[model samples]
Target: MADGNGSEKEAVVVSNKQVVIKNYVSGFPKESDMEIITGSIKLKVESGSKAILVKNLYLSCDPYMRLLMRPQGWEEYSLLKSSQGLFKIEHTDVPLSYYTGILGMPGMTAYAGFYEVCSPKKGEYVFVSAASGAVGQLVGQFAKLFGCYVVGSAGSKEKVDLLKNKFGFDEAFNYKEEPDMNEALKRYFPQGIDIYFENVGGKMLDAVILNMRIHGRIAVCGMISQYNLDQPEGVHNLMSIVYKRVRMEGFAVFDYYPQYGKFLDLVLPNIREGKITYVEDIAEGLENGPAALIGLFSGRNVGKQVVVVARD
Candidate 1:
């Protein structure tokens, strides 16, 4: 150790590992779509560039990242959609990975899409597809917090358990086990759904439209089911949207960055008080990033998937 601000430091170069897209993909993404490679970077930043170097402790594995892997113009669309409000970790006490999940883009998507877009009220029926996912889990919990009857659909029993037992959802079912989506929605929302936080698309959207109450709101954050499909399925029940006079709106999380401070103030205390809970599926090491990312399309991850690059 040396006196503060006295010693001259030497720069060190290290092997920086990265997971890069091996090639543009056409259909469902596989681990082969990406490959881990190493490059060298200086441990110290340049003297006057005003650039901040992040250690990259956690890399988020979000479903939207998959859209970028697709061939054609989607790569450009992905960049435009995902380029704003990037986070740089500052606090070290809380898990750094939270920035990639509950405190990050997914958190804002759940907050803005539900409260800002859906305009939820007390005792309303709220249904969230892909409920065990990062954004969906948060949306279900927020609906419960807002005094709504909350139900979620997942792909596996474990995810269903997480929705009901951990996230405080009123009910949850495995969508894969339920062949008739309209019946599944009917079973969960006997009174008809007033708010649907739309994550998965395709037949789920069609079913939800038919089951929506008058003036029901749908906040479209993503359409994960369509991201990998060569030909996206058509929602035949869109006519129901007009018939029921429902409000259907699509939103991106980028539009809500100004509310981030307000969101943190509301959520951080709930987390500390155990009123809110979050789950993450962390894949240790950067090399596992490909598998962790590919897992999203196949429903192999139970919660928010994150890849740990470095530990401090």
Candidate 2:
């Protein structure tokens, strides 16, 4: 084993492979848009930077990763930017790739967005769109732990089943089969939605808006449905935002990272106790990263998508 200085009596040079974004992307990024280059791995950490050097093991494939691959577009400070909350992964069990989904940004996204933004209360009726995805899955579980009646929507029948059986959602439905989102919302939330975790956006948001109880809250995490399209579908029921006196706000997880420790305190115990469950679809090797990423928009991943780069 190396000493604290990260070196032995003799200097050692280790080969390193890094996954680099080919460049900013346009439309859906292809496999060619990313390339893994080899280099030397430094065993030492630099001073004055909170950025820790990680030997990446499990990298996540999230829908928001699309924006980063996009040729610099209009998307704001999300996973897209030159140095935004992009994943230059390095995960392991101790600091594993699974952490990237449950304990990383997605975890924080669920914590801050649910606790701070949604501010859910016991017995509240909470509904989450794309509830089987990374952030949404955690949000639903958190809501359940908060003693709320939680429901979720997913694209496939299997995912819907997973949400209900595995994630402990009170109810779940396949949005693909539901011809009308409003109907699905009503069916699951007859009492009306007190908290709506917006993920898919577009029609789903509109549908949730119509069913939101008075003084309801909405945490807008993303709009995956509109990401690839040149022109996104507009919400015709925006007026409902005013009439319902609903509070709707969008958020990015990075701004809330400072409180990550506190959030983890609240979640880790539950995770260890089996009170909370997280899902991940792991892709091995950098070569599979592209397909894993592209498949996100199509709901090809059952839960959080992770890519493994190297192992210790």
Candidate 3:
């Protein structure tokens, strides 16, 4: 326990194993790009600093984490930003790892992107790409809760089934099997998409453009498909946005952190009563972090991927 002076009765040090990016990645990240190195840190908060010392129990494995691994301006800020959202682990029935998924950043993202950006209405046709992912799964669920007809697209048949059965999506299809995305969207949403939760971008965005209704809203959350590409694929459909008066907006979860308290109020009860559910692919130990993160690009993870650093 910390005292008034921000010091523990006795100093304690522990070996801290970290998975760090060795260099800026050129294309798709490999397990070799990150190395697990052992270091040591004092388990005490600094006397004057505002920093809170936390025993990191779980780390989130998100597709956006790839952006931080690349050559970016001030990578430490990305790390610190996530640290800012940490929740203390006390007595709880839920898994501690839930903080890294549905109950935390990803949940906030889905909430903000759908409600704030897309402004969905009841009976609206909502389509979520990569719908089995951390954010997308929640987005599809939120749309259902809001009384919208929701369809999800996933890579594998198993994931599509999870989206339909577990997450309660109105319709779900394996995107890998659907070579023509436009035809697939037409099959699922014959009336045309009112709100398109864009995740897997690229050619999907182009196909979605042709299927969007007049005055449609597109919440650009992520583009996992183009993240590893040397040159991102171009979407030749800007004319549709003008012709249909479509509104497309990109957003970051950090901007909506202030509404977290309200978000919890709305979601917690649903989660507790079994009205909402989430999926996670947890990898044990810090040493496995590299592999867990690298697996995301290959669609190896079924849902939200998490890496456990310590059980307690």
Candidate 4:
């Protein structure tokens, strides 16, 4: 291609692979529900345009993404408006993938929901559901760092061990083996829980509500258990909240992006000094993105699930 001066113009084009939804999902999502397709794009930004073309090195496979597979919800990344709501990676000392989990949205979620929403106090008894996950793991660690006694719940024994041994939770349990959640909470928090980081809602929420102390705070981060269901499960313990004077609040990480600088100020130092530990389950290629995403629903991934599209 030649420009106005007849000099050769260089335009680099590349194949863009995307994992797109095949159709709206009804129940538990499967790998077949999403398809990876290849398209091409010019690696150049238009003159006087605010758009910036970025190479996505890592992609986060969060549980909330399942909701977007439905017809009403929209996909997150788009070729256009790429610069909007994007944060620049300022720190290079740590692994870049950390931005997808501990240093990114999930990290902000744990920060806002735990410190801001929960109003955590030193020596408080804290309980975290889905504790081995990207956000829950950090929430447990943050609670421990805040001088609170932390207990976390996961689906499998491996994750249960990871919670106590890796993330430094005071105690951890496998929720799958516990037939009665109320009894589980009673056994873990005999004195009653001061703060509850709600992740997997449903019976867990109901159980936590029954075990909350007076003036207890519940930070509702997500309800992964009810995402793919045709009808969401009902929480039968609403009356207990009134009697216990529990303060339950639901929060969105989107509302807290403006505080990203403050979050990095606290987290980056801890990460650099080894005060914080993080684990990631990496899917090596974009083609594996579907499996990585589906793994979140079934507890297949050991830690934060991430897809690495490129290395450089």
Backbone N/Cα/C clashes per model: 0, 8, 0, 0
In model 1, how large is the Cα lDDT of residue 186?
83
How does residue 45 of candidate 4 score in lDDT?
A: 65
**What stretches of model 3 exceed 4 Å from their correct place?**
1-10, 70-91
2 or 4: which has the higher TM-score? 4
How high is the CA lDDT of each candidate model?
Answer: 0.84, 0.80, 0.86, 0.89
* lDDT, candidate 4, 206-247, per-residue tens: 999999999999999999999988999999999999999999
Q: What would the TM-score be for candidate 4 when compared with the true structure? A: 0.94
Once model 3 is optimally superposed onto the true structure by TM-score, how far is the C-alpha of residue 3 displaced, in angstroms?
Answer: 23
Worst 10 residues of 4 by lDDT: 1-10
lDDT of 4 at 194: 97
In terms of TM-score, the best-performing candidate is 4
Q: For residue 195, what is the lDDT in candidate 4? A: 100
Q: Which residue pairs clash within candidate 3?
A: none
Q: Could you tell which candidate, 3 or 4, scores higher by TM-score?
A: 4
TM-scores, in order shown? 0.90, 0.83, 0.91, 0.94
lDDT of 3 by residue, 62-168 (tens): 89888889532211111232346565544267777888898889999999999999998999999999999999999999999999999999999999999999999
